[model samples]
Target: MKKIVSFTIMAVLIMGAAVMNGDYVSAASVDGLNDKINELEKKKDKIDEKQGKLSDKQKNTEEKMAKNKDKQAKVNNEINSIDQKLTKTRNKIQAKESEITETNQEIESLTGQIKSMKKKIENLKKEIKVLKERIEQREKLLKDRLRAIQSNGGSMRYIEVILGSQSFGDFISRSTAVNTIMDQDEDIMQTHMAEKREVQNKKSEVVNKKKQIEQKKKEVEQKKASLQNQKQDLESLTSKLNNQMSEKEQLMGELKEEHQKMEKYKMSVAEKQQALSDQAAVIAEAKEKASSEKERLKQLAEKREREAKQQKENSSSTSGSGSAAPSSSGGASTASSGGSGIFIWPASGSVSSGYGGRDLGYHYGIDLAPGYGAPVHAAASGVVTRSAVSSSYGNVIYIYHPQYDKSTVYAHLSSRSVSLGQSVSTGQTIGAVGNTGNSYGAHLHFEVHEGPWNYHSGINPFPYLP
Candidate 1:
């Protein structure tokens, strides 16, 4: 009997040790899960910070692009003005060229007139010379005739001829002959004077015509010179305008290049943000699982402790009764907290905006405005697919329900209390509603999707909600 009691005591000690060992293992597992969750939280924080910086950078880039657009507009206006000036300047230059051509033609015409007048002057001079020579010859011939008559017995010979006439008929005939000779000499003198006066007048007229034509040719040349100078000035101005336009165009091209670079950089930032979000989501999912496991293990450890205590108490009480040891009980059964194909309100608020056409544009979701920082709940029990910050969605969450083959989205959150891949029950608090990500006020933007969540692919959620 003493051996049996000692053996029974030894057996109780061993069973108690086994139960304590199981409890210790579960505790260690819970601690390790806690450590993992902390690590994941730190990673999520880092990703959030990165996302914030990216959003700021994107805003800055957009501001720069807006300024660039303004500058481009100004440059375009300047270019347009320059183009107009260039057009006018070119037109003026064309007109000047035409004037220059006309001036040249006038000069040519004047030159021809001047040349013709000069030729006429030369001809008149030649005629004058010939007329002077003929006058001198005629005067000398008349003087020679007078000398010949004088040498042959002058006036007395004429008187002798008239006295030598034999009858009255002969005297009358001699007198008539002498008168006719006097009349002929006077007529020759008058003709010589008239011819000399006519030649002088023609020479003077030709000289005056030549002078007029030369003056006109000089004026036309001066006009042509003025036109050429004007054309040169216009050409210079046109060149300057063209250069200015080229500079403006070059500036515009540079701005456009810069804009493209900025856009590419912005795209890169967005991509990085997305990658980081994905990474964070993955970490969150792990963390959520770890957390859930930690809780489960903690509960299991407590249960084991209670069982061990009860067994030890019973062993102490029945140590001498010779009773058999009780077998250990099974673990606590886990209940499914999955979706039931029933939707609920995601938030407590009045609907500020409805789904579909809105004043701003097409709205695929509904906006609910509660007080600021109101708790945002899940619409149904589902697994969290995404929980991340976004440029447009801000602090957002997406959940997918397998029962209904549908998804739900909650956006514009101030803070999130859930993690990716975490199972959530209907009306579970997942976040807080506040102004974030394209929101004008403190509100929750909620949506329901028939399938997986996609941008602007939500159906009206009102019908699903009671």
Candidate 2:
């Protein structure tokens, strides 16, 4: 894969150097540094916005929780009130049942009394009718007797019945007898009529009483039915209130969890803020130094390349030209010829360390781990880039290949076999191997480049190498 390391290396190398110290200007001047600082401030503003959004979410969650709590409290009250009403209604229903029982007994008693009154009224009416018939029969008999007397030359008149009687004593006797009979008949009839009236009156009064009791019973029943309905309503309300309480409990639990999350986020933001502060300071400083040192580094590279070319020309004078192995891999033909744009293999070894991900400090090169001091070949000949010793990556060599107008870097070299600007072949020996800066053992740290040692602009070597 191509080493994806492209950078304005000539400038950024100088920035890295300045950052090691506080007061150095790099390839990009102080104006550039201020601009970078402004950029960092913009990042801080974004972080603030993010923190505000989280805080707002926390507040909104809390407000919702509070409302749910209030609703729960009201629900609880309703539940309690409903329970009370249910108890009262149940008691009322029981009381109504007892009243209904008593009212039923009273109605039964009134019915029996009416039955007895009906029997008595029937007997009295029969007696009154008999008495009326007796009076009519007696009147007819008296009229017949009076007619017989009148035909037998006897007359009965109001005066005869009084003064024209055979004697005043006889008239008094006749009047007494008539008056007595009339009195007895009237007495019988009056007693019988009076009894009937009394019975009828009693029956009417009893029926009215029964009706009154029934109406009272209906009212009581209606009230009881109302109470029962109220009781059912209360029960339903109580159940709803209970559910509300349960929901409130759940909301409270959620609220607690939310509060905890808010705290955790706040702590995380604080830590992130501190990290950002440190990073800004470091990047600003590094950005400055990286600019200047990178240029000097490139200049040093050009110097080495000129020297390597001279070495190659001198070697051709002494030994004609070194014959390389035939190109075995397809498309690897005539890779190095007269420096007319062909890249030589800098070393003979297996290629390694392809590149891509940007998170780790980027690697702009390939690593070729070979047996110690195995001949390092020039890959598709070009002038040498540089050979140096340093930190992180030590004993490094840079080669500017002619084919693609690209530079290649080799590090951790045990020894160098060429000078700067030295032209080499596709498989010319360039260096040996040894353990160098930040190296575990003898190996070749190789790289390809476009212009110089800008680590940012390089692609992985795996895709490009033959």
Candidate 3:
């Protein structure tokens, strides 16, 4: 847009310079110069109004950028918090793993103990069975001896045997013999009862030991199961934390992109403000020149009127003709009537992509393929408002035409020859087309805007291009 601003101010300057140099100045022409000055002032007011709007936009952009920064910071903080939680959860999981390991070992040990107790219990059962069989046989023998005595005559038979001894010696021997037999029977019965009680006690002790081991083993297994459950819970928590962290990081990345876009927009606004300031300078100079010319013309006309009156008094019949008005050769170049159209094709190639939506997405401008390093030209005579490298457009130039109140862009160039604020004519080489920025191949991206170029403000160039 600086291009259009400079062009209009230059026209005003030219007019003022012409009036200052003319030898025969006229009052009417000087008044016309004043009128031009007023017009320039009006333009200045409009520029001020635009600048004010731009200022508000810049402020809004900055505010948005600040908001984005805050959002990014918050996301970062959330990610950090998730990281901390993940760390703690992982630590807990590790601890649970250790507990589970210990619990498994304890269960194994308890199981071994239970197996040993079971074997002991089986051995006790076998020993008790043998003892019971031996005791039963001994008891049967005792019962048989008792039945024989009962059939014979019970106590009477034993008494008769004792009395029927042949002599005193024989009686003693028979009595001793009877006593020996009875003592042997009593010893057998006592031994059987003791053996049965010992077997029963051993069996009971083994059974009690087996029960204790089994109970201990069961408790250990339950502990292991609980540990396993706790570990599972920790693992689940860790997974959730990881997912949250990923989401937060993604949000942070998006916020960073938004911040960068806002920065670019803010820069564009600043460039426009600078252009307006330059135009204001031009208008001030033009106004000064117009006022000076007006004063000079008024004095010169007064001097001429005096001379004419003196001449009329000297020659009563001779009436002088007023000075002829200055010729209308306004010493300024007129606006260019671009040969056949308002704009010239910026590159020598067919359009690779047209303006509007396409398969990949929206195409804001036409893409031209004119080969690598091919020269790219301006579409019209205008001032260069932007000549810089952009992440998306690469080596690009922006020019504004005051004649049509429009702007044009040339982008994706191998190199740029013009700088910001430079004047360019239609068909002038400002750069060379090549693969630059977000381009697929060596090509030029051209755009035409009905007014000053802003983001996504491009219109179809086909209507205006020759």
Q: In the order shown, what is each candidate's alpha-carbon RMSD?
A: 15.6, 20.8, 6.6
TM-score of each: 0.55, 0.29, 0.68
Per-residue accuracy of model 1 over 34-133 as CA lDDT, tens digit each: 6656766875787788789888988998999899889889989999999999999988988888888888888887777777777877887888898888
Cα deviation of 17, candidate 3, in Å: 14
lDDT of 2 by residue, 300-355 (tens): 44554466567677778876675432222111122332233244445556765556
Across residues 1-466, which tens digit of lDDT does each residue of candidate 3 receive? Answer: 3323354455545655665676434455556656767876886787788789989999999989888888888888888888888888888888889888888888888777777777877777888888888988888987898899889988688778899999999999989988887798778888988998899789778878877887787788788878878887887787778777778877787788888878877877776676556556545654665667666656765765576567666666546544444456354544453323688889897788888998877887888988999999888788777787766777888887866767888888999999877888888999999787778889998888765555545777777776
Indicate the TM-score of model 3. 0.68
Q: Is candidate 1 or 3 superior in lDDT? A: 3
Shift of residue 386 alpha carbon in model 1, Å = 15
Lowest lDDT 10-mer window, candidate 3? 1-10
Candidate 1 lDDT (Cα, 0 to 1): 0.74
Candidate 2 vs 3: which has more lDDT: 3
Q: How many pairs of residues collide in each model?
A: 0, 75, 1
lDDT of 1 at 428: 93
Candidate 2 residue 365 Cα shift, in angstroms, is 42
